[model samples]
Target: LAKTTQPISMDSYEGQEVNITCSHNNIATNDYITWYQQFPSQGPRFIIQGYKTKVTNEVASLFIPADRKSSTLSLPRVSLSDTAVYYCLVVRYNQGGKLIFGQGTELSVKP
Candidate 1:
């Protein structure tokens, strides 16, 4: 399993763009990068996923460097309601298609 590192917390204001990064130094060739957002009680909601380069959805954008060792999740024009815990996941297909989650980055979106 590839270990991931992320900031413990982050702060952002309303209408601002926020970027939370995660590092995976020992990533393998077959690993895919995924990101999820979790609220206080609700289950994690899928944000985006990418193997390389950039992948964007209506919710957020995910950027993966060419080295494939790190990724960044970008949220544009955030609002107070966007405050949540974001997770960086490493998905390995051969390993029973399991999703390995790490300590998430807590984002506080202020007004």
Candidate 2:
């Protein structure tokens, strides 16, 4: 299994975009990348996910390069309410692996 890695913290101003990068150097072929955002009291919510290239939705976009060793989660025009902890998770296609928490990037959106 590839070791998931993310920055401890990041800073951004309101109305600006924030991109958080996660690195999985030993990512397997069947692995998938997913991101989740968590507020103070609520559980983490899904942001975006991708296997390769790009995946976009109403709230966020996920970018995976050809190597698949790393991924970028892009949130557009963030607000103060967007300040939260973002988690990057790796899931296997058929292999039921345990999902680990605590390794996530904390994004602080300032006004």
**Predicted model with the maximum lDDT:** 1
Residues 4-52 of candidate 1 have per-residue lDDT tens digits of 9999999999999999999999989988998888999899998898999
- Model 2, position 39, has a per-residue lDDT of 90
lDDT of 2 at 4: 86
lDDT of 2 at 72: 94
Tens-digit lDDT string for candidate 2 (1-111): 677899999999999989999998888898888888989889889888899999999999999999999999999999999999999988885877566665689899998
**lDDT scores of the candidates, listed in order:** 0.92, 0.89
Clash total of candidate 1: 0
What is the TM-score of each predicted model, taking all chains together?
0.96, 0.94
Worst 10 residues of 2 by lDDT: 93-102
Give candidate 1 misplaced runs (Cα > 4 Å).
none
